[model samples]
Target chain A: MATKDILSPLPGTFYRKPSPDAAPYKNEGDVVKKGDVIGLIEVMKSFHEVQSDADGTIASFVAENEEPVMAGQPLITLNI
Target chain B: MTRKVNTLFIANRGEIAVRIIRAAKELRLKTVQAHSVADTESLAVKLADVAVNIGSPAASKSYLNVEAVVAAAVASGADAVHPGYGFLAENARFAEAVEAAGLIFVGPTPHQIRMMGDKVSALEAAIAAGVPTVPGSRGRVETPEDAAKVVELTGFPVMIKASAGGGGRGIRVANSRDEFDRLMPQASAEALAAFGDGGLYIEKFVASARHVEVQVLGDGYDVVHFFERECSLQRRRQKVWEEAPAAMLPEDVRARLCQSAVNLAKAVNYRGAGTIEYLYDETTRDFYFLEMNTRIQVEHPVTEMITGFDLVREMIRIAMGERLRMRQSDIVMRGHAIECRINAEDPAKGFMPAPGTIESLTIPGGAGVRFDTLLYQGYTVPPFYDSLLGKLIVWDENRDAALDRMQRALKELTIGGLKTTKPLHLALAADPDVRAARFDTQFLEAWLEHRAAMLEDH
Candidate 1:
């Protein structure tokens, strides 16, 4: 097994769901594909999607939802 | 009889917070800065007589948290709360909360805030006050049949607006009868989904209009006008530049427009500093009341420059239960003043907000020029708030001179390690149409599109 970490590209509040009422884009033990949105980073009142760069499966999110995140901080870990 | 405000609490952040602190200090009132965790080192916090961390960085947990803000104000022993421009400035419930907690809300009464805060009610009040309003439905158009009736009177092009919508949101314009029928239902559904209100209103769509607003101050008994501001230059319905004593407004029309604003404020027995916004049709030379902001606005400094009055100080005094201090004739508009909103966004890249540490800062200064900012060397602008880094305001004897001064000041401002909208303002200052004072509400977005295409060719 190979492990990799997805890093946040911006410094802001990270959200796992598209909106407050919506389900999270990804969860632990969920399979993900490249270019799949896993979270959103809200910066300066604007939202940007954080996409997975590689195919992975069944890992864990390092950064919690609605928490402040910094650029280059690890947001999720994946097993390939 | 007036209750003096010995301590003032600022329940907002950014340049406005700093602006309030300065005004309070000038009045010899203690300033307590209520800030989020992310703004611990903000210039406002640094400059205040005291500081309190209300909650986390997200505004929902701090600035907009009515309970938290009110508790913080009480705990800080602050007698009055200034909500600034955003956050809870217009939230009537928040104003009520502050007052219920034995503290003064530095704005109008909650009833007045609620009245002006609603689109439908605000329009009704405008009509009742004898202020000219856009020809449309009397109140919320409940159904398509009712909307059709309004369109009959409003003509071909009409606007379908959500009574709960604001900041240019939840609006659909129909240019023809067919378009109106098709869009009316969709707009209603969207408004319900967005604002939980299916209520809608109709208004005559002014094809070529300018965004002119009159500044008024009231003490719950009397109201006075500070002339008008032209904020037609906007991007995404957000004002980018503002000028006081709207350029080329016929003196007679200006007088009528200003008096109308005072009429509305008196109707509400309005307190504190407020702005009565209007849509002015330059071709017809007719003006209609748009809405009233029951709080101090972002472009207030331009009015201050043209008329040497400290609006912030006046609002604080009004909050302390003081009566109207100045008469209508005492306030005079002397010169042309312009204000450019400097945001921490990249102008070339669709205004992508860039939040970073300020490595160096070169502030513009001289006679009749002021840069109101919450920035300092080594300050890290948090990515949590609006992109407004500061406002660069300039004043001169005439419009032409003010424009020249704005160009010079924009050139002198420099911020390191951050992308800003400085380039955008520079281009606007150089543009011939802008210099000639020829633009309407829809001008800047179209101008931005044209500028983007030009940039792509290069």
Candidate 2:
């Protein structure tokens, strides 16, 4: 079966790193476990951590850091 | 720094934006409206001097987009921006951007917004001003152990509140240490999801308290209270019915309540119209400062009706650097006024948002009646914004007369397309305790639950 990609559950600004000048939580080709925080999404001054529900190797990052993203948009492609 | 505001851009939608446009027109200021895809044909857009499409229907891409709104203002040559409640109304960053663009931000300064936006800090300011606030932690606590210690000091039945929370989100009641332990993580998670800050604070929970608030106006230096409003009729911490000159308040208690509101506003050097909310325990006859809404409140019209003052007009004038036209002694409470928020929700179905086209519309009218709505016969109530479709307000010689008028108005009003809170208002009007003015914050919820159970019983 093909690996499932992680998606943003809410509409907000996507952030690859927790804060400016910090390394991203996950990157391409990195193996991630279920519930591992992959990125952050901020909506109306609120930030929600986007987690990978399925453990898999990261295929690609669908959205750039600090860019606006919509609900149900793909954040990352994964290879189980 | 007093600049003449000839044109104002309203960066919002719904009844509030319409309210602002009407006030601007009264002031002879040209109005520019910014709309998202959801509000292309909204009443505010249709009524403005010019309407500019900002972006998509989603708030993040449209209404809340500060750059888009500012761009629209610049393009339309608007000298000032009126962010009519919600969206970017309290957004400090957006306010700063408006100032940087050389456009007036028709609210408090950025510093004031940031300082008052955080609940913990605002509470600290209230305490420093000697305002009576519920005793609790001075700042946000990080761990369960910290929360427990704070709870112990504040005693049992404490409320865990998110520092960055509002609109009834990110709040949990902890009856004991075990409950605190069970709810802390959930509260933090919800807070982090709702507000960017997961910081939590504890406060003594005052059960069965009346939600009384004092309205104040300021021009940066001078501040005055326009008296108080009782908003005890609420569901899930959201107010439904609000009336001015809160009934059952002693003369001394009322004076103290209004004075405390003025003291806090002066301490902050507040500007424009704001509401200082308080929790009044009728049993103890004591009041505690809850929080200050640094923008025009949704129920401001009730206070306006009784005081014979136009609050929105005052906000615009204050933004233009005009001094308050009236003083404390000049302000007089003329009559009783009550406002009922008409929301597009099904009260029987758990207050679920009922968004659809209005197939038919008939607003109530008569003596001492006013309906501030944006709904037309074919108007489609979009699910993008708040559920409040309009406000039905009435005024009379006394509270009883006002209540009777409200009941009649509710009966005359009709929106055939979708379910609304009209039935709920009807039930509230018929409740004995509510009619007698003995109800508190929990009255509406309890009454609704009882009604639902009775419906099930039948």
Candidate 3:
């Protein structure tokens, strides 16, 4: 019914994979459920999981891997 | 040749930006405020003559991003950069970048930063310059087994500290052998978590220690001291209250502390504003060098209020290659000054950072009362940066009078629709130990714990 974008809940470095050598939590164009973990935001040595809020087809990631991001900045756009 | 800096680019945020802008304007120099996208409406932007969007609100990508900051300075046509304290202040790469971009770095040289940045190297430098330092492990204790050797040498009641940590994080005090055995791994884990380095060092813990520091100014040749400031009142390793002309130090000890700071400054060929921190054991009356901060300190207002010198203005002038006019003897301390850091924190709730919009503000005033802040009505306090909203400094002819004035000032000041640590400061100013100027770095934490227990009983 609507297209929504996932925004980082805090300001920090956005990590695509769980670890440097691990596979990314979600890839572009992959369908993600509402509870799926999409990325991680690391701030002040603490990490917070950025989860998908809506179950939708993956549109594209706005923030690159290991990029610094601010709170409320777009991380991924989901096309429902 | 020393070049004239006509315009200064401040690569910082919050009240420090406002402080630097006012100082720059006083010298008739054009000021450029570097702001993140979040700080577009900050007071520094309003006060400065020009504003440049550096980057995002995240410090690592904005104020701390050397390339972005240097680019902003270049774009704004600034001839010099004052990093201010905290973000990128001690970063040698940022200083080198500013100088490489043909702009004056308002603090120390990159070499000086590197020499003093690392805790081990700074201790070595202090020893080399004949500045007495706390006895500890010569280098990092790589393993837990190595820690015991240091403990045997330093004895029990040892302090385990991270080599790359500051602002009080990465430190754990172990009192006995059992505690030391239990805490070494914990301390190393925290150090690795905080600074990405598990490198830990051990030092003999000073039980009755007073945090005293000497403020120094240098021109890469001559160095001058601004006496001392006592920052014994701290919370979780951060200073809560600061005062100049430290209370109750012997005259000879004061002379030695000042001279030791000067010795280290001259040894490093330090330039601009700097501070040499010392841990003074009250019982033994021995002072050991802590570390050298190669930037203008947050508590500089205390020294300025007492010595009547514009430290920020002098920093700008020195960056422009102008010689310091006043000799060490010419600078005099006439009055005692105390400063309370007005942070946007909820003291009752364990000093949690309470960031929100200020609906209104009523500041204290009159003679000897100085409120340095960027806060105003309708401004939102961003949660991204430091919790500091401003500094409340009061000055008087003596310590007793200064303390009394600070109590009155704390009462008169109010910020509507925001929870702050004003109530806690009011309590501190009234406390018996604080009134008597008797405190150590652990005083605030103990006081806070005591207050919580008292409230629980009620």
The candidate with the higher lDDT, 1 or 3, is 1
* Top TM-score prediction, candidate number: 1
Model 2, stretches more than 4 Å misplaced? A1-80, B139-202, B453-458
**Quality class of the docking in candidate 2, CAPRI style:** incorrect
| Native interface contact recovery, all models | 0.77, 0.00, 0.04
Model 1 chain B: which ten-residue window has the lowest total lDDT?
Answer: B449-458
Best-performing candidate as measured by DockQ: 1
Worst 10 residues of 3 chain B by lDDT: B449-458
**Preferred candidate (DockQ higher): 2 or 3:** 3
Please give each candidate's TM-score. Answer: 0.93, 0.78, 0.81
Clashes of 1: 0
- The digit string of per-residue lDDT tens for model 2 on B52-118 reads 9999876878999989999889889999999888899999999999999999999999888888898
Q: What are the RMSDs of all candidates, in order?
A: 3.2, 7.6, 5.3
Give the Cα lDDT of each candidate. Answer: 0.92, 0.87, 0.88
Enumerate residue pairs that collide in model 1: none
Pairs clashing within candidate 2: A46-B195, A46-B196
Interface DockQ per candidate? 0.87, 0.06, 0.15
